[model samples]
Target: MKQTRKPPLAVVQISRAVTVIRFHVCLLFVFFASTILATLPSNVLFTSTAGSAVRMPINIIANQSFGYFTKPPQSDQIGLYVRDGDGRISDAMITPQSKYQNFLGVSRRQRTQGPEYAMIARLVGSWTDCNRGAESCVEDGFRLSAFEIKTPSPMPTICGDALITSETPTKWAYRDLVDYQYIVVAMAHVKVDCDSGVFAPDIQTRADGGE
Candidate 1:
């Protein structure tokens, strides 16, 4: 006697539906986060009811002289990198608010103030807690292709700046300045889909933090 096998059409359909639902959920999360992120304070970048939060160890440098140095730090220091949905790297320093806006191009028509920039800014402010003034503040003069990853998040932690030195001889280069300091901020954004995603087909601003 031969046994007959039946097709799992119902199971297949159910699986497909589940996949679609998951994709939608992810899409919704990304969209909501991106929109609210731009308007939110850096302190509260990832506090959602969904119970997903990423704690990044922002490098806090205190009471350091500000100037252009020819040598890298003797000891390891704090640095960051910014990336977009396409994984393209930007070698911009976001320590100062002006640099953040100008180098990252947060204002005007040519700026790449994507998720990474917003995240970095928020983190820098929170790390420094710069309420009174620029004194005893935090600034990221060092350049990093990536960070040390002391702790990892379930979701990708979008860095506002890259913190590795392999890519560039110098992570940060100071112009003819002798008494300037700034706090570093960083962030990143990943697209759900390019062909049918809402955030896709978007253009990043092209400002080098220079007016």
Candidate 2:
């Protein structure tokens, strides 16, 4: 009987390379598949509640709009206020306070105040706890400069029109110049769905410490 011939070195090497390539292709496919799942209803973003209550004063940055890495921070980032007895949080678009009405395109259409947030928030973010000033100051249970403050009622945390699920990440997320807490992902002005209406704020005093 004739002996079987062995495969050449080049053939073996080529086969190994093909195996490696296939492995990489499968890995990429898995990653993209997971990202697609994140976009679906399954993966929610900013779903967890923050529990740090550190007071930090913040200053509003520029009125101009700047892009983050590849995407933009949420301009006029409508925050989710504190949770209520019902375990709900309210999410509303920033009221279009038209100090720069012309910039906002349409005039003040929100209500008594301008828009809840600016069309584009560059570096400027005021404290939510301000009494009467361009800036506001707010104190809460969360100590971090920034926390996902839940609304008093249940509302959607949206990016553009679609809701942000837990899987959604801070892509090209921008932070306030003075404080890291005021971070946002800017999405140009778009129609918003305020579930109910803005909830009454929880009365809380500012922490005496924290510069």
Candidate 3:
């Protein structure tokens, strides 16, 4: 019987090297693919209808009692600087206009007088990185496509339910005028000019009012 010949050691070694090279090439392809995806823009258009459920809860209230107000109907964007109970601040944007004008109206009233209000709302949008040289984009923040306020009804009783007067019987505390848990603030239509690293709005007002 003829003896069977084994493959040469050099050939076997070459085969192993080729397998290792193939594995590394596959790894490199995946790494580059993921990097490219990470850099792609993720701006989502706001399309939430009225009464829609809140999807992503930001769990925050406006840091400033005043200054942030609801945008007018003609404006296309709403800018906010919101903070959680712990006081962690973040930049938020409400875009494409306010679909829930009723809520915005309520907020406008409460905000104009100067009262910090909490919100229970859904933030439907993408959280993108700050622009290259944006001064106000202090931290990576949310570019809200939709904001839906969901303040619980039959307001909490911790605060006096009746509108309490501070200065006079006819004068009511601005904070007591509305349900703090469900009021709106900083819902204005403002352009986010991160390219210039400025927070300049086309219009400015002393009295204020989002989701």
**Which predicted model would earn the best TM-score?**
2
Which is the better candidate, 1 or 2, if ranked by TM-score?
Answer: 2
lDDT of 3 by residue, 1-211 (tens): 9999999999999999999999999998876564433332333533323212331221121122122353332332223454445646543332223336336444443332222122111111223332222223322222322222222222321111111111112123553663321222123221221243332222222112211
Assess each prediction's global lDDT (C-alpha) against the native: 0.35, 0.33, 0.32
Better of 2 and 3 by lDDT: 2
Give the higher-lDDT candidate: 1 or 3: 1
Ranking by TM-score: 2, 3, 1
lDDT of 2 by residue, 1-211 (tens): 9999999999999999999999999998876564433333322452213211210111122111122322533333344233334534343334445446435646534442212232212212333332211112212212223312222323333322211111122334433324334433321112233454555223223233323
lDDT of 1 by residue, 80-160 (tens): 444455656554443433555455545442223334334333333112222211221212222211222211221223333
Which stretches in model 3 have alpha-carbon errors above 4 Å? Answer: 1-3, 43-211
User: Which residue window of length 10 is worst by lDDT in model 3?
Assistant: 157-166
RMSD of 2: 21.2
What's the distance in Å from true for residue 140, model 2?
54
